[model samples]
Structure formats: structure tokens, C-alpha cells
Target: MKLFYIKAALLNTMLLSFVDDGTILAQSKQLDDNNVGLYTYNPSLDLGYALHTGTSPLKPKTYWRYLGFYFDHRLTFHEHVRYYATKAFTTVQAIGASSIDCVVPIATYGYCLWYFNGARNKGAMNQLKWMQRKAALWIMGAFRTSPTGSLEALAGLIPVHLMLKKLATRAVYHVATLSDTHPLRSMMGEGLLKRAEPHARSAALMTPAMLGKVKSTVMEVDEHIHTLTESFKPFAPEARPGDRLLDRYADRLHFDKRNPPQDRHPYLDELIANARADPLTALAATNGSVPQSNQYQAASAAIIYKGHRELERTHYVSGRVTAPDAELNAITCAVHLAVKQANCQHIMVFTDSMGLAHKAVDPSVHSGQAFSLSVCRALQEWFEADDLRCITFIYVPSALRWDIHGEAHKYVTKLKVRVGRCKMDNSIDALRSQAAHSVLDSWSSTFQDPTYRGSEFLELQWPDGRPIQPSYLNGGPWLSTFRHSITEFTRVCQCITGHAPIGAYYHRFKINKPHSCTCGAAFQSHQHILFCCCDRYSVHYPHFLRDIALFMKYNPKAFGFNRDPSGVGSLLRVGLFLLLEDLSVN
Candidate 1:
């Protein structure tokens, strides 16, 4: 039994001696490469597994490495040689026969040194915990058996390993004065310090030049830590300094620069790396793409009302307003429209009407503060969200007719008419509301099937310039039809909106002027273009693509059309219609 225990101890010793302390990584070809991985920022265990595939859940298990029996790796091929000769000679004692000590000194010496080396390696401060496990196995073997020098040798490494482990705690590590760093920070956290090396203390005290790469990371981590926790107090005591540090960092609220109870997983740094690479900041830098300029009006979705009378015309305005005591009303009008329709009460209204939006919400932030041209330009922007929209004023560009105000000569009078006490048109807002209603109606268009489909009716033209009526979709020649739909849409707007022309960003076909329709007694705008001027009785003119998608899958990229579909009016209509349909159907 004594001989068997010594033999097992010898086997373990030999295994340990074969492994080089830092070079035992199963995944890495080069031991010195610090390219373990990008530092993960989240405190998770997966980061270690990322460095080496097939890492065992039972990690901290040691692999054997000897200086002589090396694994040689070429650029293309790798080779390893493991030396395992059964015995120097056939000996009964070595074969576990309680006969005699027949094994040679060289083999015995080699085996003893291997186990002793492992025991010593484990006892090092950086790996003291692991070393204890190693030392225990050998010491127990030595005592359980009569006497084995190998087991005795292992116990020798324990006291020193414990002392150095204690020494490691005494160092005052300065984090941010140096560079960007995450892994070192990870190590200071609890549970994930997988690195086991005798030289860990030396590595921690790197030269300034060496830290240049990582120093910035440490500072960044500090900034992030400070920012994340600004709203909340520190949850742990050692995690932060006294109330003074907390007070100083109160407003900043990021990473808390305090130690966790123990070293933790290094994978968290990986998450940080990924977050930094995202491009949202760059996107926000541009603000948002400028929306189409227009007199935005309407509420509960803008409406387009077309009179089936002669002299087709349309107008733009929000809901009816209670007469304001101050400033020309057109200036505050858009702001009022924006608040009620778009739900933007905190409107930054700018108009010649001294203080309109401000008074409507708060007079302090009103139209009077802005210049004249500022007001006109501000109101011209298309209706979007409140955060991205604004209202401006004009001294009523025209009443019933074009009236030039201010300095008589400042306006190059191409054609000027007189001002009158006429009722301002709120038709644009009405049309938008009607358009929303039309979409809702489409949802109810089909009861049995409940599947109402719309197609883009297009204007077709050949290379020789013969205008053609759009054919129903047959998988090809969509360009002519799409152009026709846009043309009809623009023309309908002219009929419904009174001479307002809608333009495209990029298209396969040129937009055609819409033929005037005898709808109402007012001018036309965007409200008339989509749902108003079209057949309001039969409801045949489908204004949105979700309608088209109902018939066939709508492809914004169909038929050589190469433009982002976001800004397209048709696409917006589709999304709105689809949502309405869903709500009604459900």
C-alpha cells in the first residue's frame, strides 16, 4: 500500500513538472501573446471561456508542462511529443510488487521535482488558492504512506504561497492616472481571477510606457462607472469611499471606483468594447433629416376635403382657434396646430405674431422673439414630431388674395392684392383628418374577406415619349406605373390642395403635373393629393402601400427604384393604414 501511494504521487509529480506555469493554456499556440481577448465589461463568467474554447466548468485544473518536452507549432502545422516509457527496466517494485525499490534515481528525481514544482507554483501569491489544493494532495499521500520524499516536498511550498498571497493585498494600485484598462479592473473584482502566475505582482507594477495602452481604458472605465451610478447611491461599502467621495461624484454618476469583495470574471470588459463601437452618437450628430417643408395642419390625423364643385382649390390650417388678443393670428396658428394635432404642447413657436405659441402654452417662449424670415422658414418645415417640428409667422402672406405689407418697395410686387376680413381656410387640417378617416374606412372595406388591397396606379411612357395608362401589376414594368401613381398623387394634391406640388427625392420616373380635378371651391394641397380628389364615393383610389401589400407583397425596391423609402409619402400612408387595419381587425 505504501509503495502504491508513492507511485501515484510520483505520477502526479511527473505530470506537473511537464507543464510550464503560464504556457499551459490549451487554446494558445504562443505563451507570451497577451491577446487573451478583448476585455468584456459585464461581470460574467463567459469571458474566460472566450479566450480558450472547451474550458472546463471545473476550471483551475492544472495541465502539465516541462521545459524539455515542448509542443512545436509551425505556421501551418503543430506537433507535440509526450514521453511515457513504462519503466527503465522491468521491476516488480515499480510494477506495485512489494518486493524492492528498483526504480532508478534519475526517474525518481524527475518525478519528485515535477510534483514539488507544482506545489511551489500553486503556493505563489497569484495562485495560492490553487496551490493549496495541490499541496494537500501530496501531503496527505506522504502521511498516509510510510515515507515519500515527493509528498514531503509538496508541503514545503504551502507557507510561502500563503505569505505571498497576503503580500498581494498590501499594494495600493493607482487605477486612472495611467491608461484605459478593464482586465486589471476585472481581476480586482470577485470570483474571476483565472490568471495564475508567480509573477502576477511584477506584472501589476508595469512601467509607464507599458501602461500607455491600458491606462486610457482604466480612466474610461472610471468615467463610465461614475456615470452609470450617478442616479443611485453605492450599494456596497468598500465599493466607494466615505460620503465625501459620494458627494463629490454625486452629479457625475458613473462607475463607482471602489473594489468589489473579491476578484471576478473578466468577461464584462468585452461588453464595453462592443458598446463603444456602436454608431448611435454619429447618427444623432446629424440631428434628423429635414422633413418636407409645408404648412402642417390637421388633428386626429389630417384630412383632405374636396368639394365636388367647379374651380378646384384647397387650403392649409390647423383646428379653429379662439381669436387671440395679440399678434397677427397666422404666426401662432401653426404652433396651435402642432400642439393639438401632433401632441407637442411644449412648442418653440417662432412668428411675427409677437408671442403666439408661448401664450398658447406660455407667452415667455413665443413668436415675438423671432425675426420675420425666421418665422416663415420655421413654419415651412413638414409636420413630423414635436421635438423635430417648429412654428413660424408671416404677416399673413395673403388674405383671400396676395397683399404686400411692410415697406411697400421691399416686396418686389410681381402681383399684389388687397387684404380682407375673410375666414381663414382650415382645409389642410381637415384633409389630413379625412385622410386618416379614409385609411380607417379601408380597414372596413372588406367584411367577409376583410382584405382590402391597393395598387400604385402609374403613368407609363416609352423611350419615344408616349404617355401610357398603368396596367395592373404583372411582375415587370413597375417603373411606368409607380411614376403614374406619383404623378396622379401630385395632381390630386393640386386638385385637393389648390396648386401645391409634391416632389420626390429620387425616382425612376419624372413626376408629372396632376391634371386638375373639379372637387371643391378652394385651392389644393397635399390633403387633396392622396384621398380627397380621388373617387370619394366609390373609395377606389388606394393611397397607401399596405393596401398594395394586401394585394401583393409591397416591394419598395421593385422596378429599378433605388431610394430610401422612409421619406416617401406613400410608405408613410402604408404604415398608418396597416396599423389602423390591425386595430380594426382585432
Candidate 2:
């Protein structure tokens, strides 16, 4: 009995060992499968082995779908593309069977292509283009419609290239932000300061020049980071009274009141009437009348005096209107003049130009415009003065109703008219002299006899009675379709530019021995390549005719092919494809 018990115990020990080994093996296999799905530099060798051996617990044929993106054991999206293609076709068929608009299916497929796979891989992009082409063809066939101009237009979708570019730009902007916890920041080793410190010890072992290069690199990285941070920093509201008033004016202009304001203000009509009745007297009266302290003025003054004493506030500025560059000069001049005339801490100058007003408020925008460097220098001088607390630019409506703005506008307009007259007189004199000599010799001159018509002696003339000129060589129907390979597209462009690699051009450059075609044509020019009905070129002849037919249907006058069939050869020479079916023949 004791011997029997010993044998049972031995069997039990072996059984327990087998169970533990199996469990460990299964857990390891699971780990390998999990690693295959991860976006790691190196995946598990065990997973690859399983894939090759076909012994993987998770089948090799099975695809793994995670986080909306699909992949197989090899991390390829081939199966994902196949699945979407089928889905798109079925959706389109269903939409066709129903009463839904045909545009719905196109839109649905486009949305799927963009959002479903996020266009994360080249395979996805290819699949998107293929599906779009198929969908467009299917829709046109179902609806009995002619082929649309371009692929995107036919599908009623944004171009795939543009969409991808937009997404890429957004990703780059996100990666460039200056957050420590950002994924890109971590990927780049937490930026220059941290990256440089770790390599400092290693730098001492290098040559002096190499060490200097390393130091310079570190400094460049630091400066780059600083620039990016400054560029992306959120703009704060300008503290000046002028900017605040401008913001208020902008808001009022875009206001959505229930009782909408009239298109024309009553005060404008009254001002117009006053001006018409007595121009000189009205102008004098308007200039003399001080603008009543309205809500805009009161609000501006209140904000300016918030931190200063009542006794310190002295000067009150209104507004001005002038030319584009003159406006900037006027603002600067007005601010200085106000400060000099009345010793004041704050001065506001309202202008009729939004562009100038924005430049004054935003330093970055100001720096990029023409003549900004000089303006900045002037501003720097004013800012340095201890008494000048702030110089601001506010926007005001350029209307005759506004008395101050009207007066400024009158003076500026008169000055501009005077300058314009002087420039115009000089320009007219110069243009008149050039015009006399610039007339073409072909142009009909009064010196020529009335009956000495040279064109009547010429043998060639347009059948439509329209005068044929050198300008016709440059005119043709605009090609609305460009869905061809780069090589073919380039050939089309060359043909249009009159520099195609035809027999004649190649012979001129010594690429070919003769400029003749095998059909015994004189010169294998663009006209011969398009119009020659030789046995070798007969296959493409129908396609050329079809293109011409389509061109005539849409644009008759553009090519004038209907008036003269001979001009069809010229039409074909100007970038229109000779063989529409076979793009490879280009």
C-alpha cells in the first residue's frame, strides 16, 4: 500500500510540471502576438517564426484592427484596402437603389477615405485614389452623365493631395509647440538644454574645433527654440486707448442687432445737404465745430485715466485720414505734435485705414510691411521719452458725417489730386513719345495708299474671312483634364509651349539624322504627328478626331476647327492629346 502511494505521488508531480510548462508557453505566445501589433522598431522573432511556420495561435491570415486602423501580421494594410473597396462599392449600389441623391455616395466614400484610415500610409492613399476613380465612373454610368472635367470635381470632393497637406501641416504645428510633455519634445530628448548637458563630458574628449562646433550647435538649437516659442505665443490685448476704441468700433460694425441698422445714417444725408447748400461756409463751420464728446471719446478717456491722476491728463486727440503710407506718417506726426503742443502722458490718433490701425496694434504685422523699419525707429524714439506713456491708433469710419475725419480727408484728397496731376502729366508725355515708335509696321498707316492692300496678294487666308495673324499660333482650347502620368503631362506642356521633342526639333539638335517620318512626310512636325494618317500612326487617328469633336462641341471659336478643318491640325499641335485612350502614346 505504501509503494502504491509513492507511485501516485510521482505521477501527480509530473502532471503539475506539464501544466506549468504549457501555461508559460501560452503566455509567451500571447506576448509575441501583442508585440506584433505595436509600432515598435523591432517586433518579436517568435511572432515572425509563428507567421512563417503557420503555427501561430492567432492565425497568420487574420488581421488585427486597433484604434480604427487595420493591419495584418506583417503590418501591411493590403487587407484594409480590400475591405474598404468592397464597402464603398456596396454603399454606392445601395444609394443608387434608393431615392438618395447620387452625390451622397461620393461624399460618403470621400469621408471614409479621409477619416477611416486617416491616410496614414501610401497604401491608404493609393486605395483612396482608386476608390475615388471607381466611384466617379460608377456614378456617371448609373446617372448617364458625361465624364466630368477632373477626378475631384466628378466626385464632389477635395483633392486628396490638398487634404493630406493640410493634415501634415497641422501635425507639424502641433509637434513644434513648446510643451515639455509633448511627444515630439520627448522624441527630441527634451530639447537643447537637457540634450547638451549629457554630451558635455564626451565633448571634452573631442578636438577643439569639433567641441566648438558642438557648442555652436547647442546655441543654434536654443535660439531656434526661443524663436518658435516667441512666434507661437498668444497675443495679449493692446493696453493703449486707441486699440481699445478700434476693437469697439470693429465689434459695432459686425453687430447682430434684432432691429438692424439702416444702410445709410440720417446724419450723412444732413451733412451732404449742408455741403451742397454752401460748400465754403459749411466746410468752415464743420472745421470750427469741436466734435461732441461722444461715447467713443468718453470710453477712450476713461480707460486712459484709470491708472493716472485727473490733473495729469491734458491732450485729447480725435482722428485723421490720409493715403496708405501717408497714414503711417500722419499718425506718427500727429502723436509727436500733440505731445509737443500739450505735454500729455497718453495720446490717441484715430485713422480711417484698418490696415494701418492693425499694424500699430500688432508689432509683428507692423515689422513685415514696407517702410516699417523707419516707422519702428520713429516709434522707438517716442517710446523712449519719459512723458510719453502711450501712442495709440484707433479706427474711425471714413464718412463725411464725421466732421474731424471729413476735414482731414478734404486736405489729404486735395494734396493727393495735386500730386497725381503732376505725375499723370509726365507719364502722358512719356507714353505719347513711346506710342509713336511702338506702332507695328504691319499696322495700317495713314502714309500707305488706300488701295495698296498686301494681304490681297497673299495666297493663304482663313476660310472664315477672319484675318490670320501670328497671335493664332499661341491660341488654343484650355485643357481642363490633367489626370495623367508626370511624363505624359510634361510632354503635353512641351507641346503647348512649342518646344516638343518632335522629329523636327530633335533633327535641329542633331538627335535624329533626318526630320522625316517613315510615312515619307516632309517634316515630322507637331502638325504631321497629329494629322498624319500613315499606317504606323493610323491607330491614334480616331482619338485625335474625337478630341477635336469634343473641343468643337464645347469651344467652337477657341479653335475655329468648324470653320476650317485644316486648322484642326493646328488645334492638335497645341497640347491636346492625340490619343485619349492610350495616354502612353504621348
Candidate 3:
């Protein structure tokens, strides 16, 4: 087998070889015909050599394809974007609308390498945009003249530019969560010491000068990068497959779902009494709270006892945190106290939020890892001390106001510590929530504009009359409502876009058809059908999708021209009318 590994320090040349392909990048002080050199490797001699003596220099190409990415001499990536976009568009045309999802990723593959804001790459972006718009049109079955924004919104697709931005942002944040020893973290100019000493920075493989010369995605990461060395603790034993928290401790995690919160206090009190009566067991109750006045401020308190005698009471307050962070810390402190007990073999922890208790013992890389790691370390020691040593985590709802938990809850709630400003890092969950709110704000700004929504677009609202807002979460709010029924889903889309085959749409498009409703109302528009149509027994238009879905289910032919040949719709109406008449007669 032939093997190639070439590296030249003086000329600054490197080669990265994949299974079937390789990429070589070389640097020079100045570009000249005489200054070019060919880089070669000799496996037999274990040496790298620049063959410039009595040999013609290698010619530089205008573009090259490596590992499925096209690199242009000018770094424009125009050919790459055009190729994929055209390919996706063609594939979308050949496949059913449901398969549009398979083609979107094809057009945006490896986009992190080429996409950035204001790169003067509008041609490339336009190609991808046109491809997405094509798929959106097919998915929604909307006209070519329909507003691109409305069509993509109804199709549950983000705009091309915003999608690119979202992907780029997510990629940056993902790197931020990587372990300190990760190569990507090192390449992004961070170090292991950076988390401990926030001022410390690392010299990366790419120098500042080299970074400036390239259109790099790392440069676009901007302030999103952070040192998460403390968060990722892969060395913990709980992370192992057979020794995971649930694997070794599933039986210890107790939950009481059969009893209501009101009735749980008595059972919980009996368990506490049994624990305190045993000299070998310890009992603890923990509580955490986040004040509404200052969301970042959090407090946790725990009460530990043995043999019906109070042993330790621990409490702490932190800033720039979430409720989970506080709850996890409370569990951590309680376990730490329990582990220090002289001869205790069993420990019991009562928490209001069992979800947080499960999270505390979990060794996964998540929001409150700093607390979770501490909890895991302490519990591992406690569990390994003796075979009989075991812990039980019980659930006691805070609203139940059980004596033990209520005391801790009251203490944590009255914490007077206020943080005007601090340098503490926000928890991962808090940061993610903040970023989501920012993206929602951007969407609202664009969607609330009348011109952007188009003049004929039908606006929707919640039951309370607040204007409906768009979100990409959970398949967006609109699709999540009527996704179970194809007919109802299509009707809602048609209503929102005003692109149905109704009299108003036909008249506006100058199509040769009757522009009057069958009931003699002029222009069978959405407003007329929703409010004034006599055949449908017009009522106030619904503000919620649930109400809309029910209305469409009752009047199946309201939006479409199809009539039930079996007369199921007629039977449903007659049954409802007879029921109404019987109530009146009674």
C-alpha cells in the first residue's frame, strides 16, 4: 500500500487526506513564477521534500473539488452553491411534495464552510433561495404569484437567509459546548485554562494574521464561543454504559403518581418518621426557588436529620442561573451532608421536583453539570463505602406544604441577596432560552409588517385575541394543530393564504367563473363564508385553530366543492338539528 503524509515547516504547506481524496494548502510571502515549488513525501526515507531543482513548478488551478466541497480560487463557492441548488431543484421536481424534506439538506450541505452574513455572495444565496421557494410552493400547493413569505410560513419552512443564519449560530453554540481538549475548541483559539481564568486565551493553529486572510466560519462565531470545560466530565464512572445513573440506581429513584398532591403529605410523613427512627439512616428535604423580581437570582436550602434529631441545615444563593440549576445544587448540598454522616448506611432525599432529582443523578452533558458532577462524585463515594449503603430520592410537592420541605422553601424564598450585576456565567438552559427569545423577536418584527404579510393574507389570533405569532418550534404552531387531518390542514392553509378556488380569488385573477356565492352573497370571500353565508348558518369567526378545526370537521364541504355522495354530511346536520329542536320543545 502507498502512504502519503507530507508537511513542510519552512514553506508552510500541509495536506489532509480523506479515504479517496485529499486537500493541500500552501502559503507563500509573494506569488511569482520562480517562487513556486512542488511538495512531495517519501515514505521510505521518512522525509518531506520540496522539488524545485530542475523541475517545472506545479500549476495552480482556478477551482478544485475535494471531499464533495468545491473550492474556488477566489473563495466565492459560486459553483458549489449553483451545482447543489440546481440538483436539489431538479430532485424536488421529480419527487412527491412530501419528499421535499430530503432535498433541502442536499442544497445546504456543508453550508457552514461557505455561508456567512454580508459576504457579497447574493448569487449563491439566490440560487438556494429559489430552490427552497420551489419546494415551499409545491408543499403548500400555492400559486406562483403568492407571497414567498406566506408560502414558506404555511409550509413550515424558514427563509433561506434566516435558515442559514440559524444553522450557523447552532454550529457555533455546539462548538462552545465541546470539551476543552477537543481539537475544534483548540482551533477556535480557546484553552483548558480559559474556563478557570476567563482572561486567558490560546494561540490556535490559525494565527490572527492567517485568520484575516480566509473567509472562516470560526470568525463568524463571534461572541457565541465560551469555555465549557467544567460542563463536560466524560471521566465520571456514571457516564459508563453499565454503571449509569439509571442503570445502578433506578430502584432508588422513587415517584408517587397514584396519590394526589393533597394526599401525598401523609405517606411522605410516614416515610420520614421511619427514616428518623432508624439510627442507621439519614433524612433530608431540599427546595429551590427563583424570585420573579430577579430571574437570575436563585436560592437553595436543605434540611438534614438523623434519628429524629436535626443534623445540618445548608442554604446558598446564586445569580445568573435557572430554577433547575438551583434545584440541582440543593440536591448536591443535601447529598454532601448525608455522605458525611458518621455511621449512616441509608439516605433519603425529599424534593418537590423529581425531574430535577433525576437530572441531578444523571451524568449527561447538560445545563447544571457543575452541580450534577459534584452530586455524582459524592454519591459514588457514599455508595461504594459499603454494600448496605443506599440512597432513596422521594418526591414531595412544594404546594403540599409538608412540614420539612415548607421550612426550606420559606428560607430560600426570603433570601435577601440581590445581584446588581455579576460576572457569573448563565446556565446552558438559560442561555438557550435567551437565544430562542431573540430569534422569536426577529421573526415577529418581520411577520408583523403589513407589507411583508401581503395585503390579501388572512390574519389569525389566539382565543384571547392576541395576534398569532410564527415559531419554528415543534413544527410551528399552525401545523401542530390540524396535522392529523389532510382535509382540515389544507383548508387552514388555503384560508391563511387566500389562495383557494373561491369567488374572490377567481375574480381577482380575472378567471371566467361566477364570482357570487351559491347563497346569492356577492364574492364568496373568506369573510363572507366565515360571517354572512346563509347556507352554512353563519356565526362569529373562530379565533383559535381548535375551533377552526371543529368547524371544518362539521362542515366538510365548506372550503372545497366536493359533496358527500353517501350523505354523511346531511345525516350529521339532521341529527344536530333534531337534538336542538328536542331541547327547545322540552
Q: Choose the strongest candidate by lDDT.
A: 3
The residue ranges of model 2 lying beyond 4 angstroms of the native Cα positions read 1-57, 79-122, 137-151, 154-158, 174-180, 188-230, 234-262, 265-586
Better of 1 and 3 by TM-score: 3
Model 3: per-residue Cα lDDT over 168-250, one tens digit each: 76566566556555555544554333333232233345567865665567665544555222255645666778877567766
Query: Where does candidate 3 clash, by residue pair?
Result: none
TM-score of structure candidate 2: 0.30
TM-score of each: 0.16, 0.30, 0.73
Which ten-residue region of model 2 has the weakest summed lDDT? 298-307
The sequence of per-residue lDDT tens digits that candidate 1 reaches over residues 1-586 is 4553453343212111113352323232343221232112112445544433433344332333345332323311011111211232234223521111232221222222222212322212223233333332322221222111122122222132222222221111223111223355442322112242223333244455654443332323332232111111112221233432223323321222224333322322332233235321010000001112222222111111111111111122222212232232333333333334333322222222223323322212122212122333233333322334333222221121211122111221221222235533332222233333443333223211212111222222333344322221231133223333333322222221122222210121244643333354143233343334443323323443434563234344322111223224444332332222121201
lDDT of 2: 0.37
Which sequence of candidate numbers ranks them by lDDT, best first? 3, 2, 1
Compute the lDDT of residue 302 as modeled in candidate 2: 11
Give candidate 3's whole-model lDDT: 0.65
lDDT of 3 at 61: 69
Q: Higher-TM-score candidate among 1 and 2?
A: 2
